[model samples]
Target: MNMDNRRYNVNARSLPVSNALHGSSTVISELEPLHRRSDVVLNEQGLPRHSGCTRLKKLVHKSKIRFGTWNVGTLNCKSVEVVGVMIQRKINILCLQETKWRGEEAKDIQGFKLWYTGKVSARNGVGIIIDKEWKRNVVEVSRIGDRIIFLKMIIGRETVNIVSAYAPQVGIEASLKELFWEDLEGLIRHIPQNEKIFIGGDFNGHVGREAGQYARVHGGFGFGELNNEGQTLVDFSLAYDFKIANTCFKKRDEHLITYKSGASRSQIDFLLVRNTDRRLCKNCKVIPGDAVTTQHRVLVLDVCIMSKIQKRRQVVTPRIRWWQLKGEKQDIFKRNLLDKGIWESQGSANIIWEDMAKKIWEVAKVVLGESKGLVREIRSLGGGIIVYRTKSSIRRTVLKPYICVTMRKIGRGTVWLRKKLRELWVKLVLKLLKNFIRTLRRRKESKIFIRLPRVGKENQEI
Candidate 1:
């Protein structure tokens, strides 16, 4: 019942109910708190031993990298919500199918960049969204078509190729399906053997729970029954020497099923990785409780990758509280400067200025204190947190002669109020102009009628 021991229940999800009562992988030995040193546990050999007396054979020093695939169905007005899901779930990269955004360029959404490929009309669009931190490392991006997009990034010492694809549905024409496979095969064959590859998206297939002769490509933990489309996926994986990561891990029915309807459930989404780097994957499962506006649930794959640590630069500036020198404080500064043998001054204009400045600095250090350190942080749209430490306060050192004279004549009483009112007026005018321009553009795009002549009417007759 304790949340701190939730990992104990995690292991239970893998074991059968009968195995839990029979102590298959775990022997509680004692029901007391887990921190107790005297609590004895049984090892694999059925030998009683203290919990702390044993050590694990290996320790993995890797970090988890989350990759997700989702058939969002449409991305017209769902950019914010979809990006929010990626951030909340800590997904490093996500492949979105059926984006429904008509564009062939990359755009910013929240703290992520969406590299989408689609035609003028919104249909069969595919995109890949990556964290802003990784954007700089992307070396190449190829927009194959509305159904496929490729991106390559330099991760550590290795180059990783990520392919986001949306295959034709089962009911599509056979020629289109063949063309999709041909394009996919060309992409795979072009990549070097040394680099890592990850292909993820909606394959629209049911691989079933049997590997048959394609055991190297398909794992036995698949969901639903194998069909012709699934066989095509298996053949493609075998040809490219890739493994279907989603079918490698055993999960509950809810986790195994990726697509669900009112009463039908199946798995159509999948993730593929190189067979040699199979150990890089830690787990693959489907996440529930998504908005569920679409029938496809979110499929996630956990991979291990090297962590990137960047050194941050800190800047500090010196600040002096000039306002502290007033009345008696001003007189004291003058008296102190004079006392330091000011009568014995003899130098050129520059030398005299330097000496006087040095003396003033020493005197101020004794009379007034420096400003406290202030840290300013700015969150960038690319998902990086940058902090700036100011060493000194920003003080105006120069002003126009007219502005200074006006301030002196008007006094400080109404200066602040006048400045604020002027700023507000400028802002109001700018806002009105912006709204008018926006309305004009909208009307122009919509071809709304205006009291203006049509094309060539000026030369002809109105």
Candidate 2:
């Protein structure tokens, strides 16, 4: 609900880069690809390490990453100002869905690199735009079947994989619906485990909570289940760890509707971010730049600064140590060789050795009947085979400590599988249970038939 309604005097040439958070610069330096990994194909146009690139300047200088996602309802050749405003948001990225223009025609715009459709008059197509500096070294993967376009942009030093998607309005056609979700899943799977990603656009679905302040908002979390159109999108959002970017719909004074006359427009467009997505800066938003942009206003996002956070190191302490205790009362066999307390107190520059005794312990427990009882250190993490020799003959064995593993896996119940089996059994049992209701109904009908004056035994029986 705390939406900023501040207006900017934006000019095409000298468009002021807004810094929402800080006044000074703290942009992260352009990265040099790790030379150790030769598989990484270097970008020839990558800004030199010391060169102050414009994209990098905006990262720390500007507070918000301005972005807009709109349906652009008007015909291709119409609405110049609307298109300009969409680009003017200086949108770090723009997702324009249902644009009637083709990719070539869409590229004719003064600013913003366009990722558009092949034809000039497509009923539906999506486009992507990046700052001119970003356009030089940006790669894209468009999954046309799902109607989604993914862009890989190295804005300065950050490598962001942004996906712009448009889901088909819900319908009974299984082929279209299935292909949409399947292609999306495949795209997500291909994303590198470490790369940061943002998925945004006109999902045409509601993802609203039933109890939140914005509950009435245009089905925010894809109106969950109530409207089939909203359900698919919401479910996908949930399955993936995506946080809702546009949480607030209308600012305190702004009208409730964003699209229609007298119709409450509670925000439908979204700027979604993954939990692990790299953040350029904290202050970012989807602001309404111009009202005339075909109903859906321009989304203006700003990021004042970007910096890397140093990861904190955690120190782990073991539960027991042999040398820490005084005498034989300490049954622990393993020694704490690396403990700083022991070294500091004794002032001994000595290394405690486990192999000093030159004893080769067999994998089998001689006392136990089971030959597969492998002897291994508790903290050791690995798998291996262990063979043992008996009095009569040598026996082959598996190193898997089956008993210990099963014991450790105990408390965490298998309710996931258990619930599925339970529900299936419940359905079968419920099928048989319906017979009792049928019997009761039959008895009630017979009693009523006999109560009738003209009803006879034959009539009651029938």
Candidate 3:
């Protein structure tokens, strides 16, 4: 058997291979090094060879602010728990629906502050919870009934208006749904175009997975099928030029579904922003595992503000002890003014008022020094009134003098005169009793006997 010789004589045959395969192999080889490297290598122009199709690089230095929306069913005893979750998630601002907390007020839980609005009955409420850092930046909070609330805050140079809306459920009355839409539209219309608007809430409508006619507003990444209620939401987005952030990014089914109960799951809750500012959103998804509620999941949106926030510097301007002018410092100040020849100066008539004012201020500074701290001394002829030097302090001083004058006028009336007469009568009766007791004790010391006056049985003679 010569099988070894036959195998050596066999020639290899060439087969047709596609150029695409060859090119892909070369591309994969080139990308192998990049995949192994932890950092991307910049090209000659100082940009990655294959930069992603995103403008996020421009905001590399900016910080991401996480905003979330959740339908908690009822905050009742879970407010602290909700805040705890928010802190863990690092969400800066959170829009809440179905708060079930009555009244319109802000409550501080841990480091978060919740501004909620509701009616007398504990149902269908909305609120916005902001972290401690952003609490001071809040300029206004507008509560519209129990279903809608608007929070305006300054972030860097931009004015951000966050609207928390709870739309009527799918089976709710038609009139109520229309009213909600109308109110929402009016709110958006009133917001200045230059400001950033973020409307986050439980919209209670599924936008579906298909954009169809709503390609501009719906991002085609939603869950479930579109219904009448969903159509309304899409139309609203189209009218307001808002991009439904929930459907903007592709994600797994679990991450796209916001509401799950029993055997049903859908994407009713949504986060929306102006279409023009869509690029500012880095990511938006439903956190399925971090469940604050039984049915609804937290839908979070990461927004990167491109503007750099400049820290405000507090200028502590020295305040003159003007109250001292009412005391001995008055004479000293006048003498110093005269000594400085500020008013006696025969300067040119063309001298500006600023220069003359400056000269007077200089003389006053030397005579009555600036206040040392918050404490200010207000001297009267009788005594000194020490109070904190603040606007409220001035208000109190003004009101106190007016109140004293009012009391003086009132004291001259008949009622106050009767009160004074009653007081004087009590004092006279007590003084007479004391004098009589003293006389009796002196007489007893001299062993003198005195006959007491007879009186009625009820008032026995002493």
Candidate 4:
């Protein structure tokens, strides 16, 4: 009776007061669950309605090409074996030094092709090996003696020059060393500025651990202390605006050192590219234990070519054949322009010029018509050879060895002529000998001075 009397007295004072008190308790109960929960939620109906922060996804299209260099000591018998290592590492182009393979020749081994140049004696030589995928793209191969060799190839609308160089040792003659550098510089100078150049070889120098004064070319992360040869290399890089690719990335002593023998270890080999193309080089490091040779380790460089995806639609504007506007077509075009009142247009000079141009284009389109475009057909001569026919003459580009001896013997007219003459002389001699033998066979006792072997048991007289 006492509790019921107190509740009835509180409610009798104000009905609204009791209702407000009940609503506050309900709100507290709802908030208590929200405070205990770990998940966060936004208001369903609000001014923003969504988050202010946004997530972005990036779309990047890039093609990667791997370049490597090694001093194989001698590549005569190990051609197939070294190619195996290249395939395993997925190297597209490789530079070899001290190949000791005499004569300039292009040999194919296990799908990989090697273009090498050396002297008569098997001593120092340089060569470039391209993978099967890129072998067909080679357009030109230039051999600068036995020390330097380079090739030009087309890779995705870009022209790339790959050079393989072998510098002389420290103990070599000073004059010869200078000559080598001079030849290298000359080679680089002749290449067009638009093309990409990658020089990978055993430079036989140490750029030091710090860039110091050579910071422009050296990347501050190098091996060993700087020497005279290293300074020469740094000077060359400065002159040509090149970056020592191997020194650009930070690496441990093991990966930084390229040549190791006994307790001696140093980074003598290097890969270089133009300063403008430095961004294309993603990584450069030495691969240990996978050595095809003993002293020098394999240096691999990762080059990335970023091709932007074009999103805009290409608008091919129709080109009117203005040359066709003659005789009746020319009169028709003039009449249409006059009928359009292009010359009588009134306003500013810009307005009159725009009207005139529009009228002329419209008249020309109706009178002359658009061109169908030029037709060009490219023919392949098989074996990496192509014949390009132009308005003047047909140009032949040889990328690899052709099956035909005459085609392969191009550029050596004297040698080819001599070979043909010798072949003809041999055929004539063989024909005369065949006739003499036939005469001897016809006469049973004609060969009394010399006895010929019996052709068969049925005709044993000869």
Query: Could you say which candidate leads in TM-score?
Result: 3
Instruction: Write one digit per residue (lDDT tens) for candidate 1, span 187-221.
Output: 89999998989899899988888777778988788
Measured over all alpha carbons after superposition, the RMSD of each candidate to the real structure, in angstroms, is 23.3, 32.5, 29.9, 31.4
Writing each residue's lDDT as its tens digit, candidate 4 over 1-462 gives 553243222211113225532443223334555334322122223222123311122234576999999999898778888998998888999999999988999998888899999995568999999998889999999999999999998876678999999999888999999999999999999999989999999988888999998889999999999999989999999999999999999999999999999999999999999999999999999999975688889999999976554443434344677767779878888888888887798899999899888888888888888754322221122212222323233333432222222222232446676567545533443353455556545654223121111111211222
Give the TM-score ranking, best first. 3, 4, 1, 2
Candidate 2, residues 259-376, lDDT tens digits: the string is: 4335555445566666454244343344544655546654443433343533334333322222233353222222332222222333223432223221112111111223222232
- Our tally of clashes for model 2 stands at 25
User: Model 4's lDDT to the true fold?
Assistant: 0.74
lDDT of each prediction vs. the true structure?
Answer: 0.71, 0.46, 0.72, 0.74
The C-alpha stretches of model 2 lying farther than 4 A from their native spots are 1-64, 78-83, 102-108, 118-122, 141-143, 170-174, 209-226, 248-258, 261-266, 278-292, 303-462
Candidate 3 RMSD to the correct structure: 29.9
TM-score of each: 0.55, 0.46, 0.58, 0.57
TM-score of 3: 0.58
